[model samples]
Each structure stands twice: as structure tokens, then as C-alpha cells.
Target: MARTTKPLTNTEVKQAKPKDKVYTLSDGGGLQLRVKPNGSKFWLFDYHRPYTKQRTCLSFGSFPDISLADARHNRDTSRELLAKNIDPKEYRDEENRINEAAHSNTLEHIAEKWLEVKKANVSADHATDTWRSLELHIFPSLGKVPIHKITAIKTIDIINPIAAKGNLETVKRLCQRLNEIMVYAVNTGLIASNPLAGIGKANQNPIKKHLPTLKPEQLPALLKTLAFASIKTTTRCVIEWQLHTMVRPSEAAGAQWNEIDFENNVWDIPAERMKSKKPHKVPLSDQALNLLELMKPISSHSKYIFPSNSDIKKHTNSSTANMALKRMGFENKLVAHGLRSIASTTLNEEGFDPDVIEAALAHTGKNEVRNAYNRALYLERRKPMMQWWSDHIEKAATGNMSLAGQKGLKVVSQ
Candidate 1:
């Protein structure tokens, strides 16, 4: 006959003394208080593996840390697993592995990992702004949530209040960043799917405001003033290059020498630097080339065609040209970005192919397929159009706007 184990009391467990050999005080149901020869006491559950029928011991915890009642409860839980044909130790191990994965795959942890991968691809200022925005807004609310557990509804809850505060643009940007992070998480196997997909549809659209720009008649006076302005020669050249190319102010300010191909007469802005995330080819007009040659003496020593006067190692700030424009007393009348508007308006009215003008401006297509096709199709037409625009600007600036039949270019009153 098999013997039945007796239950132990709290007093018996506490008062149990260690002998020369380690021994256990049974609390029935496989629960035991193990007393070491050196006087250490621990609660352990002894059981047989369900399949192998082999005896195994699992520690509940130290005595007092795990009271007698708690040990019995742990023993009963393990027995339940055994009854279900599962090994208690294996079950515990699996639970611990799942918990470890959950702790490491929190939204904040995965966002940091995603940011590490992005830091190399984006500009330093952009990367810094992205991280700062996350820290200030998104992280405070969602950082501790497991990436897999975050839902679209929860994301909206966090961002909608920001939109309600009239920062819809910020909310839109935040949603974009979150979508990128979640997409990274999905690609990396941290999450099975992106929860923030289509999140922008939930955000309020920001009001669109066009930048203040010059009328056709105002261009000549603005150009004449810029020519005689007491600003730095580099600033004048930046403004001229921007006007000729119709590139964004940031693109012109951050221009690097290596991106310029004087041999091909092209300025190849890298995909990472461009807002469109695709390489842009700007066909340099002869006038644009002349401006470059004039700028070479002042900026040739630096990597940037328009290096910052305060820090030659870095490119000029995007605001330099705009500030120069402000100083020229065109603060509300015009902006650096307005150059693109004026160029686009004038070129469209001058009978240049709209696609060619768009290509010269480096405006991205509505989708990937169209963008790829536009970049290849409009290269040749953009070359001649660029030259004509340059010549037109010079003629207009010199007060000779009557281009009635010159090179098939026509001037229309605005």
C-alpha cells in the first residue's frame, strides 16, 4: 500500500530545524518545505512528468517569502497542468518567454529601433525633429503599450485631441511618423500588421495657404533690387540659382558641390535630400552655370555651393534667402518659395509643356508609376525650356519685357 503524505502547518514550517542532511517537511499535494543542512529553507513542488512519469522538482520560492498557504496553491496549480497532460515547468517557461518578448517589443522600444534605421536615410535636422515630436506627443501616451496590442482607435484617441486643439498639421505629421514606425515593426516581425494604416483619413485636413508671391510686373523691380542689394554675394547667387531652377529654398540652400555635374550641366539632387524621396535632375541653364562660376570664388573651398558664413563646414540655412528677401523690403510681397510659384505661373503661360515645366520644378507625380515615367520622358524638353526661362528673367529684369516673338517665347500680362 502507498503511504499518504501529511500536511504541514505554518508553525511546523517556521520551527523546522536543519539536521546534518537536507530534508523536507511535506505539506501534501507534492508541496514541501526543504531545509538545507546550513539552515536555508525553500518551498518546492515535487511532481512526475505527465508523459515520461519522471520525478522533477520546481522551486516555489524561499520559505516566508512564499508562505505555507501560497506553496500549497502553487502545488495545486502545477497539478492542474499535470492533469491536463502538460509539464508544469514547460508551461512556466513558455509563459516567461512570451512575457520577455512582450516587454522588449513595447511601442517605444520598437520606435527607437526604427529610428536607428532611419537616422542614416534622413537629414540630421529631420531625424531630430521626428524623435522630438514622438517624445513630446506620441510616446507619453503610447510608449509603454506593446506594439502588437496598439490599435487604430487608441492611436486616434491620442492624436485627435491634438487635432482638436487646432494643430491638425502636427497631428497629420505625427500620424505619418507613427505609420512609418508601425510599418517597420511589421516588416521586422514585431507586429503582424500595421494598426495605424489609413490613419490619415481620421485626421482633420489642414487649411492650405499659398505663399505670398510677386506679380509679373513686380518681378523686374524685385530682381533689380536683389542685384543692387548689400547682401552677401553668396546670398545673391543662391536666390539666382533658386529662381532659375525653381527648386525649393531648402534644396538650393543645402546644395553641395558634388551634386553639381558641370560637365552634364545638371544638378542631381539625391533621393534622400529631396522631399519626394526620388533623385531629381535639374537641367542647369547657361545663366545658372554663370551664377555657379561667379559663386565658385567665394564658396569653392567648402563642400556646399552656398556654405554658411557662420559655419563653412555646413550648408547655409534654408532661411538665409528668405531673410535676405525680407531685408530687401519684400517681406510680405514675396518669399523664397514664391520663386517656384512665379516660375510655374510664367512658364505655364509661356506655352512650355506643362509636363516639362513640372519636371524642371521636380514636382513628384501622383503615384510611383507616373513619377518614374515623368522623370524619363521630360528630360530633353526641360533643357531648352530652362534656357528660355533664364533668358526671359534677364530680359524682364533689364526692363525689356517685350518678348513678342523672341525664340517663340511670348509674354502675357498678368
Candidate 2:
């Protein structure tokens, strides 16, 4: 037995009462509106497909947004699909799934999810840096777009504005961060493409000022000025360690006493925290050994090798190193990053292999083979290399050019 609903006037339908009464409203086609007792209206098509005998209910949108006429139009269109052997409800479900997936897999949403997933893996200090760059520089601009929609033009729009203001370093870092997130998204099936893959270094503002390292000759003067910068003890320790071992400043700041082998004279940085995602074994130089010895008594109980009593949580900020340069009047001339430059420059002058220097700095490459091959830290080999380097800096900081020959020179016992 089928139930039939009476036709209703426009005014009656507009002020429809809630009951078991079902009002049938014409939708200008074979589709009709069925109003339930709850006053919720739904549109259903009554027309059979042109060639098919099966009657299907093609759902149109809800009452308010979709007018009765449009509902009828959509129902007719669905009927056409039915004629072509397609189940409209099933097709609509597939389309809805795709739309929902797109909304979820949008670039900004996925990047944020990636951040949340890695929150514990990265340090408070490192996590904050990555977040700040994305929130302030990258996300505000491109946060809503789907990751695959990220094109070169969009990248330029996001990056060039910052680059024009001489924030080339920031731009470069933002690009790297974007690449990291997008690559993560691609691997996880969120996106089919990476915006950062294959774009050469030159494409990212190649003409910008490249950070330079202190030459072997300049090391003496630079060290002298850096040590005497008259700032916090933490800055001095940071700069000294930067020169002593040539490890990245962030790695040095995050170093723990347990990671440093005082007896063996090595700082084994875990692969997770290292920039290259490979373990780095930093051989403690004579000076590095001395520095640790001095620091042992200061913040001995704290986990951080270079701890700040100012706060129990954070070790130290990157600004500490830069401010030290500013105090020594090398503000723009020398930055915390320049310490890496100085190390790279001096290592080359001292005749160490380029690959060794690259490994020491934890630089990863595009070639997976080369990257895996160069991950070896060469600790015993790097020991004398670091020791010679530390001694070389000490001589220069003391203003003696004759100290250059003294490098790698062993003292013979009488």
C-alpha cells in the first residue's frame, strides 16, 4: 500500500505545520517535494530513465539552499546518468568522497598535522623555530591551498616579497621547510607532487649574498675579537665550541653531558636531532675538552652541557651567538652561521678532504648513494683534525702567525 500526500498552497507550504501530514509540492518536472510531519522537506524524482525501467530516487540538496525547480533540474540530470547505466546515488557518494578527501588533504591542513605528529620528536627550541617560520612567513599566505596546487608562481609570490627585504636566509629556510612538509605529504599520500623537488639552488634567489667563512689568515683576528666580545658566558662558550669542534651552533647548544664522552673525547649527536638525519660524532678538541672541563662544575647537574640558569627548560636561543658578534662590532659582518662558513673555509685551506668537511658539517645531498656514503663521521681521523684546528684558533686569538706552522705539529718529548 502506497501513501499519497495532498497538494498544498504556497502560503500553506511556507507555514507548514509539523504532523503526520505529508504535503506533495510540484518541482516543475517529474521530481516532487515530500514534506514530512517534522516539516523537513526532501525532493525525490518520479521519472524513469529514458531507456531504463528502474525507478531511482535522485537526492537533490536540502530545502533552503536548493529551490524546488533546481531540485527538479538536478533530479533530471541524475535520471540521465541512470539512462547511461550509472547509479546516481553511488556516483554522488564517490564525488562527495573526493571532495572530502581534497578538503582534508589540503596543503595547510596536512602541514599542520605533520607538525603535530613530530612535536615530541623535535625539541621545544627546534619545534618553535619551524612553527614560527611557517605561521608567520608561509602559512598566512598559502595556508588554504591544496599542496598539489602549489606552483612555482605561487612559490614566488610567497617568497619574493620577503626576499626583496634582504631576508634571503629566511626565504631559503622557508623554502626548505615547505619542501620538507610537502615531501612528507607526498609520501603519506596526501599529495601527488612536491613543489620543492628538482628546483635548483640557483632558483631560490641565487644572486643573494652568500655567507662567507673566515679565511685561515683571518681566523687569528676573528677568534681574538670573538672571545673578547664581553657578553654572557653562554655566548663565549657557544662561540668557543663553534670554533673548537666546527659543529652547528644548534647542535652545540642542545648538547647533553651524557652525549659527550669526556674520557673518549667525543660528542655523539643522535641521528634524530642532527640536520642530515645522520648521527654526527664530533671529536672534542683540546680546547673543546678544556671548555667541557670548565663547564662541568657550573651547570653540572643540568642535562644541557651549555645550560641557562635563567630558564630550566630552554638551553639557549640562537640570538646569543649573534649578539656576541654584535658586541665585538662584527654585527652584520659575522653571524652565528658564519662560524660554519669559517670552519668550512679553514678546513679547505688546511687540506682536509672536501667530503670530510661536508660530513663534519652534516650536509645532505640529492644523491642518496653519496649521502649514505658520506654519513661516516671518521671520528679518529677527525680527532687530530679538530685538535689541530682548536690549537690553530688558540694561536690566532693570541695574535701569532707563527702558530700556523704549529698546526698538526706534534710536540716530541725530550
Candidate 3:
């Protein structure tokens, strides 16, 4: 039943017919080619590895391009590698790893690396909002697709639905963000042009400007619970301080212990930390002072005045305090940010210098000449205004408003 052959012959290969016979021809010392009827031939080599007793079959290339003679030569080379106690599978995997690593140095990979680098410069809230616009709404549809594949039509498809949902602002913001990301991508040679460029003529709906600033009557109930009692301690203090200082919640939320000068009752916000990217000094009101004094026992040992109650290393998540407002039944009723409207309105009506109030809130370039001359101009005057506001707010929190103060208020009838 066993006929021994020393070497495979081309005549044997040519005479083969589909499924008729599978010829096992010994090419050399160990290599064999199983010639099939379908004209398909495969090389199989069996030999004992140097360190292992188990004999394994090593597959070389198929016939023609790999003749039986060459298979024998390759089999010898493989045995040489095996004699060095090296695994062919492991060696193949390592070679693949090197190739993959070389390929990962492409433009697309570098763009992602750039995004991670830029993330450190942006606030956590803005970073979340930006990445959401990029990843969910943008990426799945275009992620694995090369960066260059993003054309105007494709970008339009991605943004049009967002515009149609009456969220024109979000779409616009997303477009702007994509432009920025792609421009960075372009500069890094990831792509040539920003596909988002000049695509604005698309039928994008307009952004809705509906901030949740409350009516005068609603401010008291909002502040009352926020000042002393209802929400969690960290939440309450954050909202109260937010109400006290008209700065954006990000500026307040990211506040470090070193930024405040409690002894002087003056808080000088450094330029880099300011929304305007200019130094600002907020005069601390008695109420703002009291709020800080109360928070000291909780976080005096830490760097952030209000260290995230959740962890020792990380600051609070940007949404924690805002979400607290929604939980307290102030969803769309009173936004944590609407406190800016309260300050802008209250300060303007009080007959305190308009410029001073503007500077206190760190509004930039409203008075170009004044802005140019004075960066920290309000530090001294901001102190009294801040304290006066603390006094005025204490009255509001207790439901006692000066009638003179009431006249300037625009009351929305409930």
C-alpha cells in the first residue's frame, strides 16, 4: 500500500486530475508536496525541533512559485531557525508587530495623538462637548475612513440632521470644532484641506439663544436653597459662590486655593485662568467671604478651594454642580450660569460705575481705551462692589428686597 518516492516530479504534478489522486511525493529529506486533483498543491514539512520531542509540520508556499526543490531548501532554513530554539509562529508574530507599529506612524494616528495633546489646554466641560461632537456625531460615520475621505458632501450629511433638529447652534459649533480639528490635522499633514471649509452655504438652521436666566421673583427661591440648605454641601457652596461672583462656572469650578486672598477679602483671578485671558480681581462681598470661610474647614488642606467631593486627586466633574440644579427642580428654571444675568442686571441698576461692574465681571474690550489701560483696574473697587453685592444678596436670599431695588427689576408674572 506504500510506494516510496525520493522526489516530487513535475510530470506527476501535470498528470494530476481533480479529486483523482493525492500524490504524497517526498521532495527531499523531510519536505512533501500533497498534489491534489484540483491542480492545487500544498507544501508540508515535518521534522523534530531541536529542543522539543514533538515533530511539527511547517507549511511553505504552494507549488509552482514554490517548487518541491525550493520547498526542500526553505525547509532546511526553517529547521535551522528551529535548531536555534526559536518558534516560527512567535517570530512571525513579532515581525507582524514591527510592521504594524511602522504603519501606525501615519497621519491619522498622529492626528489622534494631537487631539490628546490639545485636550490639556481646553476645560473639561468644553473638552467633553467638543469630543462628543467629534466622536459620536462625526466619527462612527467617518472614523476608520481615511481623514482625506471626508469631503464636503460627507461633512454635510453628518451636520444637516443636527441642524434640522432645531439645534442649529450645536451643528454650527460642531462645524467650527471640526474645522479646528481638521485644520490641526491638515497642518500636521493628515489631510490637505478642511472639508468643513466654505460648506456653510448648506441649509443649516440657526442657533437658538435661549439661556435659562430666571425672573426676579424666581431668583430668591433659587438662591435661598442654594445658599445654606437643600443641595449637597459642595453643590450648595458652588452655586452660592457662582451667584456671588458673576464669572462663568468653569472659572469658579476650577478655582484653586492659591488664587484667593482671603485675608484681604480680594480674589485676584490670574490672567491665564480668566475667560478673557486677562487677570481679574473680584471684590469679595461679606456673603462671598462667608461662603469661602465656610468652605475652608472642608478643603483647606487641599489645593482646590472646593476639591471634588468625589476624589482626592481629581477636581469635580464639570457637570456635577449644574446637574445639581436640575435635580433641585430648577431644570430650565434657573441655570447655574444665569447668575451672570443677575450680576449684570443688579450691578448696572445700583449706580455703581458701569465700567467698574464690567471690569469686575471681566468683560473684555467693551471700552477699548479703558480696557487697554487697565487690566486689573477693578481690584480695589471690585472689593466694595463684591461686598455690597454680598449684603444686597443676603437681603434677597431672605425675601427682603429694598423697594428701590425692586423698581429696576423686570418681573415676569407667574
Models, CA RMSD each: 5.6, 6.6, 10.4
After superposition of all CA atoms, the RMSD between model 3 and the true structure is 10.4
Candidate of highest lDDT: 1
Leading candidate by TM-score: 1
Better of 1 and 2 by TM-score: 1
CA lDDT scores, all candidates in order: 0.84, 0.70, 0.69
Which of the predicted structures, 1 or 3, would earn the higher lDDT when compared with the native? 1
Off by over 4 Å in 1: 9-22, 35-41, 48-55, 67-69, 80-87, 106-108, 116-129, 135-165, 191-205, 211-217, 224-230, 322-335, 366-374, 399-414
Write candidate 3's Cα lDDT for 1-414 as tens digits.
Answer: 966656657786555555687766666667887777777888888776556657777778787778756777777777677778876645666978866654554434544676686665654466666676677787767655556666779878877887777777777777776677678778876566787787666865574666787765566776555543455666667766777887778878777778888677667777666656566777766667666767778787887776787784555555666788888777876677788888778778778888788777777786767885664565676777877776666666554322112232222222
**Tens digits of lDDT, candidate 2, 1-414:** 865555434565466555678766664445677788887877776655444556656667567577655675687787688678777777889999977887757667888888887765664557778888888987787888877677767877777778778777787777777778878888887678776764325345546676544556777677556544556666677667776777776787777878987678788898766765667788777667767766667667788878765874557665677666777877567777788888788879879988777777767678987776656545556667777777666656553222122332122122
The candidate with the higher TM-score, 1 or 3, is 1
Q: What is the lDDT of residue 173 in candidate 3?
A: 74
lDDT of 3 at 66: 83
